[model samples]
Target chain A: MKFEIMRDRLLDGLNDVTKAISSKTTIPILTGIKIDVTDNGVLLTGSDADITIQTFIPAEENGDQIINIIETGSIVLQARMFNEIVRKLPTNDVEIEVENEFQTHIRSGKTEFHLIGSDASEYPLLPKIDDENKFEIPADLLKAVIRETVFAVATSESRPVLTGVNWIIENDELICVATDSHRLARRKVKLENLPTDVDSIVIPGKSLNELNKILDETSNPVQIIMSNQQILFKTDHVLFFSRLLEGNYPDTSRLIPTEFKTNITLDGKTLLQAIDRASLVAREDRNNVVRFETLEDNAVKISSNSPEIGKVEEQIPVHSIDGDELVISFSAKYMMEALKAIDGQGQEVIVQFTGAMRPFILRQVNDDSILQLILPVRTY
Target chain B: MKFEIMRDRLLDGLNDVTKAISSKTTIPILTGIKIDVTDNGVLLTGSDADITIQTFIPAEENGDQIINIIETGSIVLQARMFNEIVRKLPTNDVEIEVENEFQTHIRSGKTEFHLIGSDASEYPLLPKIDDENKFEIPADLLKAVIRETVFAVATSESRPVLTGVNWIIENDELICVATDSHRLARRKVKLENLPTDVDSIVIPGKSLNELNKILDETSNPVQIIMSNQQILFKTDHVLFFSRLLEGNYPDTSRLIPTEFKTNITLDGKTLLQAIDRASLVAREDRNNVVRFETLEDNAVKISSNSPEIGKVEEQIPVHSIDGDELVISFSAKYMMEALKAIDGQGQEVIVQFTGAMRPFILRQVNDDSILQLILPVRTY
Candidate 1:
């Protein structure tokens, strides 16, 4: 394999693929990124058994020489070192070549690096996906959905299925749900064009985070293909594939209550700041719980107490109030996460409660598309 | 103590004092910051046995009200929590009140925090300096000197004195030296005013780092007070105190050779990047060493090799060359640190070598105020 590519262009492609390479992977070949040089351009691939990423660099971009492919061949080199060398290389154009013995030579300006490479054939082949099951969504929209719900997934690995976010599609509506049993986050959006079929898939939160990191926030659409056990998201020049978890997701539809005895609407920023102050005291406790008490005339009391770190109480004004007077305790971290996911500046949010013992819901005052629920902590 | 102070002013003072408060200290009271409200203003102090910081918030600053003292008293509160609370408070003016029972109430806007406070009597007293040994230096210059020499101190606790930077004053010139046996850093500055006698002191690197973080890059002067067991730095309204190390610092005067067999001049940035690239390959080896081979006519060859990570070689252009060709291997990290300390962009540095086994020196082309020496690694 032999090619000459721009320094920044190659670094960008390498960074995109490197998200899938893991240093602790048991598969030795998975630690390296595969480089395939063709007459058209060059393709870089990296995987760690769970997820695979492939990025392509074209021959030219904007009338500037991006890649010059001299021969067609393939080789695998260490992902981390390769990325660092290309980034720190002191020239505008870098020349990369692979010998018959797989000794890769990378030269830029006066800097040259010779790396031992492995046979690309040793890497596990990526599974093929049918294009018929693919659907399109804006890259930013997908990233937003992942960021809103992925943090709620259980990360302990004790329940492997709970570590994944459940994606459900019905009647051209897509809903994503993630929960760690203590708290839950769900987001729903209407699909632009979809087939009259229902489908469900559970994707690991880890994979979604990696996808979020690599996906650019552009209007460009990303094509997603789903199979029985794997899913793939393809963008302009990058392909991301991840294995799905097998298990039945809990029926969270029944978990959110339809009626509430009390509802309080308050500015998200004000409430977030109040909770942040309370958290400084509550975080010393195991559950990190803070209590919220609704007062008369659009006022609320926030308080947290730790035996060792003392206590903190804050009064925050609300926008509106109705229904029963309520007092409840929940994780301060969960509340902060819910507030951050809400869109719009200084928008008011309604907190609905069925009872102190049941799970309560937090929703935007004007919209119900995104809902975050937190179970109250029982304090004696 | 009872006072109403500007939120930002109180927060700034709290943050500076909190740097000396360590949660892991065996002395429990050291984790709290003591606050004294007097008729003059408010004084905030924090200490962790090894270091102490005290900052006074005056009644007014630049024709603006900063502190309004209502009562004269004192109390201590958890440093970390107090700093966080003050920063997150929602109002420009914060009201702080201490009850007779030692309960502290901090109110900002509608948010209020009630913290269990400690008796100020339990906190350690500040060290006393009776002697009038004092001098003044520019804050930026002191910060620069600390940054250049502090990184070379030994981190291991086997020799506690080596973890500090030695400061020696002679003939109105302040000389700072630090080393961990493998490498050494020295910086000297001539002062306008001289004390009657010469003096030397060792200040812990950790304390200096904390001081550096709190210093603002202004032309303001920092007054230094040296005593038998402690050193104090007073800048504007803030006072910083650090305990001196007891043992004698090693004499590093003879370690830097005055003459050399080979000397090479190169650009600081170019050499730094080449070493960084070579480090990617050398890191896989046991010693993590990179070699530099001086070539004829203003050229230097840099290379590194590891059995598992392959090899890398690059030629860095130089400004000038002298003496014989030389090949020496050393730690890439140390070399990079020295390069970062150079004051000017595109500055040329002369690297002087005595022998392959001796320590090499790096100095600016026309300035002898700063010097860096690195011991060569045995590559065999």
Candidate 2:
């Protein structure tokens, strides 16, 4: 590939694709980034075996020229080293030229580098899916959904399907659910033009994390297309493709409580802080367990103790409590994370539980878009 | 002990002494912090086998009462957990009361902690260093000296003395030298009340690093007292004790060349950046070797090439060139680090070398307080 491109524009394109590059991949070519220069612009692709990212820089952006294509060609350069070289180049523009042996020369100002490049043809072809099932969503909203639910996904591979966030759609309602048995997080967003053929699909939590980071750097409309086993998230100049899990996700609807014997509302920030203190001495390997109990005075007691270290007790005032006084215990770490995920400007959340041994549900008092559930630990 | 102290004031004391608590220490008591509530104020102490740090909170500071003394007693609490608990307490003041069997109750607002404390007698006493050879230096100046030379100390324990910085005082001048054999860094400062009996000593680089961090957070005079095998640094409310290395530091005077065949000057920042780019393709395990050669046109070519990676070349402008034409190779990593230590305010530095195989010297033109030296690597 031979081209002269603005350093900043090329660097940006390289960075986006770099997120998908696996340095420890078993495939040699996957460790390199394929660069293709054409009359249209310059294209960069990076991929591991499971996911791929491609970014394009047009010949011109807005009214300014971003690339001057002298020759249309392709080559692959070591992703890690090439990115570092590009960042440290001393000029505003970089000229890259690949010679006969695929020895690519990159020059910027008085500095020049000749890199050993691999044949771009060795790179695996990006999977192409029929565009019959696709829908557009604000990139910001998708990022929010991923953040709210992805954290609850199973991190272990014991049940491979649970490692992904389950996406379900019906009647133009986009729902995402993630559960690791002990806790579950679900978020729903209304869709305007939901594709009729699209059904439930499981996308790996890791892939969602990478896509969320990309969306964080941009605010644009993202078109998502789903096929039999692969899904793609495409933005203006970037395309992110991820593989889907094949097995059916477990039924989590029954895991969430339908009725409650006790309901309590408390400020999210106050409860989060109280649990944080109570967990200070709790053993991390023990899940940092903390106990909660309702007092007749309408205040809730949060406490935790480590036999070898110390014990902490906190009396946090609550907005209200109904039904019988309740006592339950759960992982303080999980509770704190749940509270933080629903946390906002003095906002309060209602906790509904059937019994000490049953799973409890937490949700913002007035918002139905997000719900979190945690299975209580038996500690009488 | 029974007392109520401002949370922030107590926290500051805890943080200062907590630096010396070794989390992995074999000595069990070293993992705990000793807290003594005295008639004057509260004192906190933490120690590992090698170093100890103590901090005091006065009853009043700047005419404001910092603590309300109810009784006097002493106890030792687990350092790591107590600090975390103190940081998350819910009130402005924390009330601590020790009852029978060393059961300590800490309360703030409606939150309380019952910590298992050991008898304070189990804690090791801070070594008492004689004050006969004591001298005072501004905390900022000591911190600066540490920063300038500590990086040159040998990181490996193979050469025990090289792992510390050699400190010397004579003729009303204090000079500190450190070297890992391949390179040497020396810094000197004029002493006003030079101790007549003090000659030379070596302080562990790790201890100096910790002291530098403490100094960075405060501005006050630090009195350093050197004894037979220990050193003590004392400030208004803090006392730091560090053991001295027994062996004599190697003489590094001969490592610095007094005359050279090639004397060149360049902009520190420019040479630093050029070397950085050249080292990008160099093998990391081999110190990222880069070559430098003088051109007849008063410019120097900085280049590096790796068979498996690539080649990089840069032409850096020079301020002046003296003596003979030269081509030499050295560790780009060492050169960059040395340059960064001297980098500031677009300064210029002089490079002096005897030949392609001799050790070279770098200094800030006419500034004699600091000097850096590096040995060359022979490359055919």
Instruction: State what share of the real interface contacts each candidate retains.
Output: 0.91, 1.00
Clashing pairs in 2: none
**Model 2 agreement with the true structure over A71-187: per-residue lDDT tens digits:** 999999999999999999998889999998699999999999999899999899988888989999988888888889999999899999999999998787998999998999999
Q: How many clashes does the backbone of model 1 have?
A: 0
Question: Which ranges of candidate 1 are over 4 A from the true structure?
Answer: A62-64, A196-198
lDDT of 1 by residue, A198-247 (tens): 38889999999999998999979999988878899999989999999998
Per-residue lDDT of B1-380 in model 2, one digit per residue for the tens?
99999999889999899988888999998889999999999999998878889998998888998899999999999888888888999888899999997999999999999998998987887777777998888898898788889999999999898999999987888999989998888899997886778689999999999888777545577898998689899988889999989887877786778989999988998999999898888864366899999997779999998887879898999989999999999999889888877663378899998999999989898797888899999888
How big is the positional error of residue A166 in model 1, measured in Å on the Cα after superposition?
A: 1.6
Candidate 2 accuracy as lDDT? 0.89
Candidate topping DockQ: 2
Q: Kindly state the fnat score of candidate 1.
A: 0.91
TM-scores of the candidates are: 0.96, 0.97
